[model samples]
Target: MTRDRFSYLAPWWLPGGNAQTIWAARAARRHFGPAPRWQRSRWDTPDGDFIDVDEALHASAPQAPLLVLFHGLEGSSASQYAVAFADFAAAHGLAYAVPHFRGCSGEINHAPRAYHSGDFSEIDWILRRFAHENPSRPLLAVGVSLGGNALMRWAGEMEQSATQLVCAIAAVSSPLDLAAGGYAIGRGFNRVVYTRMFMGTMVPKALQKLEQHPGLFKREALLAARDLYEFDNLFTAPLHGFRDTVDYWTRASAKPVLHRIRVPALALNARNDPFVPAASLPTLQDAGPSVTLWQPAHGGHVGFPVSHGPFGLPGHVRAMPEAVGNWLLAQL
Candidate 1:
């Protein structure tokens, strides 16, 4: 694994980790830039649920490279990062697709089962389908946050087999160790703010699913849950067939399987990311030969805010996606 491959420089205004992370999502308006026109495709899963993919095509290339994106938890194709990447792909004449996780595609899934950190079946299916359907175009993939974890896990699980399908893979702000990440997000302000934000959407969705499918979820227990750990313990674990939260986290964490990844892969994490601790990251020695770990000092989760260049001239604001797109382009 290479150590000097990635170096991130943040904007002068955004100093700390929290500032960079929060500002990108809350304060920065232009970060999303102009929205791209997308064509929606519905894919039917084997379990009867459906996954929605929003595709943005290149202007004139039948065999242009394709980039498949996986969004973070509770995020959809409309997410700022996803849109930024879609726009980047379009501008660079590359085809892009953002796959929405189960129950996140603006329509509630039919089955009670939804996506989790370790649920790699959907992504695997999507990659295989794309490879089969678009044999002429080279394929690349990127994932953010929870989606990143799942992508890395899937790549590692596939090992040497993944090189046949994907040319390269990149993951941003992935919680490699689920337990540490869960604990980090459950403490102090992160618990009060981020955890609440996550639960605000998660609890309602779980309740809605329960309402749709009676006897599938324990309403009382789910209602009482206030954080991710509790929610996962009550719903995510049991629904996914894990014995408990610890078991789920242990088996789902990508850290253990990272060394098994054989395809050219990059894992980017910020040292001060609120959702994941630095301890969760793998050292260069521990990483697979094909994997590169980019631990920037101040990216703050998936946020890598760049300045508008010297003299405050207008420049690219989406640093993370731009960097990722550049890296993937180089790989191709």
Candidate 2:
């Protein structure tokens, strides 16, 4: 697609004309709103890795579908989006689970290598365990940002497998192109805040691993790294067997995997999202009919808010989880 087309599809938000800005403003209000509390639990995988899961059940759902949620990089079950979505599913009589990745659950994994954007093995394990334990119930997945990438890729690869447990899936603000994503947040003020936020989680995880093994990771070099791309290049790339960060991004980006998704999948992307470049998103050709790509003119990153009243919270902003809930119900 041409640059002009990309701009038209994912243009910058202008005053009163930008969905991204409006979404952010509305989401900010809803995000800060009070929410219901749920019980949290930790599950151990067969490989000795631990993941935190938040579960909510409704009285109406004696045998409802399970909606497993995955959060973005450095995000956890505590993330506003994850918790809100879980609550939304519960209201709609669907069971919900949000599994916190490697160290994001407050407890670091036993292994030295931490979770990355395309860490599918843990999610695969979760699916297997859930299926084995609850064979009667159908399983679905919803992912945001990095989690979206991993979930989408896993769905594609598992399309023809014997354990085709997934019935449907959805992802929001997925950085289909990791290389572009890094570039999006690489330069300028975004780099400073986002990079630090990512490192705040990753560095400590690495340090914890270092505290465990002491010799495996080059602590000094990793500590001195400046950007996400550099940090991944030094640690994530080598640990995962790619030549470097570039190679890891090249192989791990989910754009190439969209065509293989056989199950119903909804992917939402916004033109003004800071984390994903509009040009890198998959179109009808890249994503087969099985994948429905939803793009609004404006919604910054994960923000999607609709106005409800002059002073009242926008219904769309409050209804995102409901939107997801409704989608899950449709799949049933």
Mark the 10 consecutive residues where model 1 has the least summed lDDT.
26-35
In the order shown, what is each candidate's alpha-carbon RMSD? 1.9, 4.2
Give the C-alpha lDDT of model 2: 0.72
Per-residue accuracy of model 1 over 88-132 as CA lDDT, tens digit each? 787778888888999998888888778899887777998998898
Error of 1 at 258 (Å): 0.9
Looking at model 2, the pairs that clash are 10-271, 19-298, 20-298, 20-299, 308-314
Clashing pairs in 1: none
Tens digit of per-residue lDDT, candidate 2, span 115-229: 7777776668887877777677788888989999988888777765513877778888889889999887877756776677777778777777889877876889988988898
- For each candidate in turn, the TM-score is 0.95, 0.87
Give me the displacement of residue 316 in model 2, in angstroms. Answer: 7.2
